[model samples]
Target chain A: MNAFIVIAVCIVFVYTVGFALSLWKQKNKIGAMAVLFLAVIALVLPYFSYFQS
Target chain B: MKQNEGKIGIRDYMAIILLTLGSKVSDDTPTLLYKTAKNSAWISMLGIALLSLIPILFLLKVFSVHRNKNLHEINLHLFGKVMGNLISMGVLLLGFSSFVLDTSVYVDIIGSMYFTRTPTLALYILMLVVCGYGAKRGIESIGSAAWLTLFYLKATLFLALIFAFTKGNLKFIFPLWGPGTLEIAKTTGSKLSIFADFYFLGIIAPLVSSFKEFRKGTLWAFAIVVVEITAALIIFVILFDFTSIEVISYPFHETILYLSIGFLSNVESMFLPFWLVAAFIRFSFYLYLVVTLFGGIFKIKEFEYLVPVFIVIVLFLGIMPKNLTYTLPYLREMILGILSPLFFILPILMWGMAKLRGDFKREAEQSH
Candidate 1:
């Protein structure tokens, strides 16, 4: 659904920016981990879309 | 004492007030108020504000007596170790439980509204990790971050409300006071949850630079509440009339969704990031306070060690409520029946005890 796309994109975008800011603050480990974790979710989230009513 | 080491300055205290007030005036409050007071939710907010003064005055009296000591130290002084520790543990439990419930509700709102497909557990983990990171940074970081978050939150909310006003309907808010006096009382009592967490201010009081500045900060904080309540009133009157708002889980979010500016549609999405940031800051600050309170009470040297344990507790509490219907009503009742008394009564009792024992003078002399 359109709701799913909008949310996914928004979450990714916001988290990416937040992670970048964390990196700038020298929280590199946290920043890197956040991106990697969310990236994996972003990839996998689409597969579950078939279950949506 | 070193400049940064002793106590926080006026700016920091101001930041705390803003942060505290901002955290409470989120997506949840308006809906809760509407449900309780019907069309006169704004009136109930004003009533609650008046009622809240009883507690605030008590807290101020306590701080006036104790001067610079935090809540934990004062408790230890008054009740000694065992009873003080027990009371401190009670406060900790109340704070932590409330924070967990709040954070979960926030996550659920986001998940339900936006990411319907994503598991609630995923959202919970994400929020907890971020909260833990912020908590690890300590009070100073939280204060400064609060300053920034408050700025964005105010700006975005103001803009949204202003934009929504252009498409306004004055007719929606007819017959301001709803059915009867008992209904108004019930609604006002139910919405006391918004002010329940003001108890945390006692613990943070020592960090404030001066009583004069803290008083000024409290005034500013109250002004923010006025603004929040007015905005909610405006939105309710304009968008939902009265009956419809009472039924919605988050009437404010729904109001934002109805907002449109020419080519731009569904601007609530733009507001979502700000909402998330605000929620994270609020939840994390409360969690940090809970941990700090536990550490201080138990005489633990390093509070950071308890972060994981608290996180696990929050996770359990967050998931325990099966759905919003169950969770919200329970929260409302709990705040009014249990939390409100502690929030209002404890500070007064502490202040009285401190005065009666002459501990205040002794503590002041010792500190000097």
Candidate 2:
């Protein structure tokens, strides 16, 4: 349960950072890339490691 | 002619910092520090207090470089419009979320402790109306109100502590260092949220009369921080055994309730009104920051017009959270941990970069 909570927290943190980056680079491709990177991390990291159990 | 060209005196700035520090001290720190650090909470608070100076020093550096510019204006100059706006928007959202979470927790405490029959939504609405009125009055009114409230707020807090003084046990505070230094440091990190309000200082610093006043105000603010933490630690040490303090939800409020005058009794009721006033000031300041940042980011000329719109949005968001239990922790972890740093760190970094690029010197010259 703690692991799940930690994972959820990380996902939320990454998502917020990505969102801010998107807003940061409104016209730049880097913003989109940042968002994509965060999204991928959010989706994959939890399932693959400590939260996998 | 700047919109808010009125320069506030040193006293006014002192009052603002006192109110800001006082607001957080009463609402959260007592209970939170008690829970996290247990019997050794006082030491933990001291540690946090010392660590908090880092952020203040960082803020002072930022203020020295950009004498009178608020975070929004500084960011725009430093990062350019798009990136700056992005950072400012993040800050706005972070402020908004914190307001909602803090207000909700306060309402929950009120409802649970005092007005059991009142629906939480009603409490939120009532709070919003009061805070909105303060925000609409502008910074001068807010600062003046803070000044006025400081006297009564401090008096009531002291009175409550005195009432609880007889019941305190010094033995409960023994073994000054907790289980380990590592544990104390970890708890210090968690309690660092109180200083998170320093982010708002960036927005408020320019409103101060002069650089000297701003520095003095921050020093006074830090003093208040130490006094509040010490007083709260003493109160918690007296009221609860170490084991019980850790499990308690609102240690300070619980202490207040445990306090009793010979005949009057129920003094916590008196505290509620004064505390509500402080909370209103705090909530309004954050709401105003959100609207102002949103306007600055989007290039909207009149942020004041968005006041009503954001009030409605704030009301909606405040109500959307299912309950205090779920929302409060989420806010502490996600909002404070992640979003707040963007507000505090980004501005300082941007200011540094801008200094490197000669923006601060150029702007200073232009203004002169």
Candidate 3:
């Protein structure tokens, strides 16, 4: 994995975590989970092809 | 000028329409037309304009009754919660995919055409960050920025097109119906989604100062975009002819590169900033729409916060394709094919529902 991709994903993960926690505090569990799920998928997408190469 | 809270007036609304839809000519849009219609691409464009007017008028009629409701709200009211949310979600999926593909295309244009040294990921990130910030500021700011720069953007574009026309061979436009009338009609049908952004404008219908202004702005902007794009198609054919243009991915950019103004040898750099501004505003508006629709679907009130999430997703997905120049167009064609029927039928369906529900009759009664 490239360092830049890792750094970018980490930064996005941090933002996602903060947002999901806030949504969770507000009792919007589904929304929070959806956000995290989407973020994870987005983060993981590049790695599939990366490993293939 | 005193105005309603967070509302954009007719000029601002028109500016958004012109920039978002009008800028289509500068990208692979013309290439798509040229590939099928050949020298008669402009005719297909005109056919598209005429066909597009039906749905656009239907959409306006729908909004004329539901004056205060945006698209999602109107869908819910007309179709009830379960079905409406499903439709809106489908729309969101289509719109989101279009955004990702379109933005990737623009980023490819920037990366491949201009910044040959920059990595795709970096360019995608930078483009999305600027657009996300604009989206975060809200549509009012985006509209104002678009309106402010609208004149310069169109002026630079007009200058380039005029120069290209002068350098082009008028005879190349001969054999006006390049393939045939049937092919032109088919092209028009397949690409009717070129005007599909008009459907997305419903997302901001209530944000416009008045329904009348919204209707008027949409019509005026629609007419202007049709003429502008048709003229661009004809001129591009005249400039490069159909054979050369079919292969040239970004005709407008190529035209600018092929132009020189008197003393200046290269003028594409001059047009770059204006085009960049339009591109930024265009994507910013798209981001705002996607996030807005996402929020509406997911029951999230503050959808603006989702902008960053979407930006990250779009960036990653956009940079995924190893050979974007080849892959993006194929994907875009598929999206356009999918969106064309949806774009045509949805508004008319909504209007039929509205009619059956007596929404228009109620509006008439209220007016009386």
Task: Name the docking class for model 2.
Answer: incorrect
- Model 2 TM-score, 2 decimals: 0.80
Candidate 3 chain B, run of 10 with poorest lDDT: B1-10
The C-alpha RMSD of each candidate to the native structure, in angstroms, is 9.3, 9.3, 2.4
Which rank order by TM-score, best down to worst? 3, 1, 2
Q: Pick the lDDT winner.
A: 3
Per-model i-RMS: 11.6, 12.4, 1.9
Residues B297-327, candidate 2: write the lDDT tens digits: 5554444544544554455455555656555
Candidate 2, pairs of clashing residues: B168-B238
lDDT, model 3, position B310:
86
Residue B349 Cα positional deviation in candidate 2, in Å, after optimal superposition: 2.6
Tell how far residue B362 is off in model 3, in angstroms: 1.8
Give the chain B TM-score achieved by candidate 2.
0.89
**Clash tally for model 1:** 1
Q: Per-residue lDDT tens digits of candidate 1, residues B215-293?
A: 6777677677666766657666576677777677766677677888678897888888887877777777787788678
All candidates' TM-scores?
A: 0.80, 0.80, 0.96
